[model samples]
Target: MVESAPVAEPAAPVESAPERVSAPASEAAASIAPAPTPAPDLDPGTRRGVPPVAAPQPSSVPPVVESTPAVAGTAAAASVIPGTAALPVTGGDALVLRGVTKRFGSTHAVDGIDLTVPAGTFYGLVGPNGAGKTTTLSMIAGLLEPDRGTIHIGGVDAAAKPLAAKRLMGVLPDRLRTFDRLTGRQLLYYYGVLRKLPPAVVESRTADLARAFDLEDALGRSVSDYSAGMLKKVMLAGALIHSPRLLVLDEPFEAVDPVSSSIILDILSAYVAHGGTVILSSHGMDLVERVCTRVAVIVAGQVLAEGTVAEVRGELTLEQRFVELAGGLSDVEGLEWLHTFSD
Candidate 1:
């Protein structure tokens, strides 16, 4: 009885601290977050947030880039032009030559060559007298056949499709043999008809050329009566009248007067400015060096060097390079006595 009195009301065992309350599911989940999703495969060492590597896929589709075929031998002769590489033709490149070659009996006029000419480029072809510059140009202009090679003009294959390729080009050969009896205007008209140009267009172009080349005064005159410079100008005008994508000239300034030469140069420059391509062959290194964006130096039916003016010239001046590469001078020093008077 005495012991029970002391324990009096030992508080009904303070209800074991209200059973400890468990944390809510949301709070517990946040405390131990799921391991971060592993980063996707990508270029190694790249920073986060950068684009991930594209996954590989099995497919039969070919890649977008295709390899270009190699050109060699006569088949590669078509690419023998200078400056043309930088000036692509109107259809893709004004011209292309791949493994082309031409032979005249024992002489291989042109060896394997490759060339590309972009539209609106002023190109110069320079070489010694027999370096095949003319032969290469003739092949490009469709005047000469390559023994082996592919020639394309504005994407039209010259050998396989001569007519189409010729339509895009105007050629002025070193020797311009025309119908001497025909008047300058009549000659142009005849060529216009051959080219199948619209009558109105041909007429208008002819008139424009006449005025531009100062040929209006000579329009009614027979070609046979025209002076050398006049004939050259007329031929140039004829080539330009068709508005061809390419103008090919071989020794255009030869036998021309200074004033006429300047005019021709101005016209050619203007044509290029208006998006036309020009391929000129000239021994006048000064003229070529002054106007050409690029040049090709050929020697004995092969390309000795091909590149921009600065590239071809390198450390030597254009004149110096020409003299060195063209063999030796003609020994003009031996003729110095021509100026001496007998005592």
Candidate 2:
């Protein structure tokens, strides 16, 4: 069973401090079962959708559809229906951050970061280590509060109407965990129900996702026993089960096998094709260039540049551009005395 945790209360004011929303304890401590040993001559049925070890690498996955900006806050209109206490956005970006800031003791982890994400866009957030990418994503996902600034989803103020704002989002945080006591299928079922999906619908989607992600054979095993790659796959499946309007993922490809990574790429592409928005942060510059239509480079807690990939890259590759944007490395130093060794 997952443990419960307190949710962040509304903030004092945008001018005072940022607000953070904590995950329920159950999610924070969840675990997955270990992967079974691979069979050299396994067939499709026995493999349960797992691609053969010799399957094409992740690079072979096709590029997702090219994304274009959508009227940001227009979708919020649907939130105003009887049961929802919608955000107040009218005609703006789907996601907006104005002067968002966060601090820890004397350090400013994120400083006055402002961003706008259009609906149905595939946006990437890239930064150097300790550049505040994770911190910024955490705040945006409502896991941690910022010290100052305002956040809006579909024009609804996130701090003021978190429940409604969150309902429209599915998040896969960098440090996410799952319920260790439950099986893979059980974990997805819990989240679907928590998101208020109908039981039959939840069951059907769970089966489809398990098959798609190649977790069908392991559905009945305990999550705590899963391999690192398998765990990442299951968490990803949970993130998509709700068919949320927006997706927030951090280092989603980390630890995943190449074949499984290809599967995820296809899934995300299809989601965006149907109008879902995705925001992701990764160190893989090449992957970002291949998958994202828009990109943002941040350094020292602030955005260095934000625009279409072509605009940001200009004549330089995204990595070269990122190096220039985030302050490229100085000439190699030290180890002057090092010499080649020979047996």
Candidate 3:
């Protein structure tokens, strides 16, 4: 059985925060960090995890990396050059988006955002609610059409040659919807089959992924019986079966338990080390800062900052920098009625 989550000491409030203090390590961390859970034993796979409770990773000074500018445009639509090649081609960049925009009636969910993710990078996309993070990811995944701009996946235009582009990617949507009646094994088998893998290969990979994700015992149970964390794990396993070059995941770690999150992180780190690219959206600033090689901060559908964690979060922690870029935590004043409640 997976060990229960660790209980770390709570952090002091921001008002009296210390300068560069490392969070005390959790007792469970020592036991969990060892060989009980090894990295995924995969032949090869694609894709890319909570309060991942353990030692709180501090965002101390990171090495300086130059920023990559993503300029916004007032224009509603972008023009693509006619006769451009749409076939898949190898490129140094794993993904690129230029002047991307998505409109929902009057609202511009994603407004003129530009981003480039290099091959083998673990990139994080972060923003507050309705900041176009999801919208931007959806467009890249080909779930939603952008009003303007072009997206390329491994140099294959996502909009112009969507099928070819999708072939290079594995996506874990923010909303988790699946055949809940199916067993975890069944789900993974079906995923592999859909990816055109032979049954024999799918079976072998399924067991490998299940063991890595600690779902070996749960594989027989229907997905509906699984907890939120298990559901995420199964879906993540399904996403990786095909071994696509790029993984576009949105909120990949939300609601995940600490143990599962740690396993997933290990798997992703290994995958990136083996030359896979991951672009994921997350709300955990510290987690992103620690795991991601690059990060992009989007606010009001515009990229406010883009670059290495060091460059964007200069003097402050990632959370503090995000709050500053996101309009500085909305003046906290008027709640006098709450102090004198009816109770």
Highest TM-score: which candidate?
A: 3
RMSD of each: 36.4, 15.9, 17.1
- What TM value does model 2 have? 0.73
Per-residue CA lDDT of candidate 3, range 1-343, in tens?
Answer: 0011122211110000001111121211111100011122222223210111122422331111111111011111011112211122233898999999989899988899999999878999999998999889878877678899999977878776655566666677677765666678877765665544446655765766776778889999987899988988787776666555677778889989987898788776655654667899999998999999999999999999999989989999999999999998675589777789695
Span of 10 residues, lowest total lDDT, candidate 1:
11-20
Provide the overall lDDT of each model, using Cα atoms, as 2-decimal numbers: 0.59, 0.62, 0.64
Global local distance difference test of model 3: 0.64
- After TM-score superposition, the amount by which residue 77's alpha carbon in candidate 3 deviates from its true location, in angstroms, is 46
TM-score of 1: 0.69
Q: How would you order the candidates by TM-score, starting with the best? A: 3, 2, 1
lDDT of 1 by residue, 1-343 (tens): 0000111111000000000111232221111101111122223243221110121221221111111111111211114211111122233466778888999898898889877777667888888887888888878766567999898876777766554465566677666665656678776765554444445544655665665566788988877899988987777766654456677788889999886777677666755654567888899999999999888888887777778889989898887887777785776777878899999
Ranking by lDDT: 3, 2, 1
Candidate 2 lDDT tens digits, 1-343: 0111221111100000000101221211111111111112223243211111222223221111111111112123123222222122123366899999999899998999999998767899999989998888777767677789999866667788564456556677665454555677776765555544445655665666676677889988877789988877777776665555667788889888888887777767655654567789989999999999799998999999999999999999999999998888887678565665657
RMSD of 3: 17.1
Better of 1 and 3 by TM-score: 3
Candidate 2: residue 170 lDDT (0-100): 62
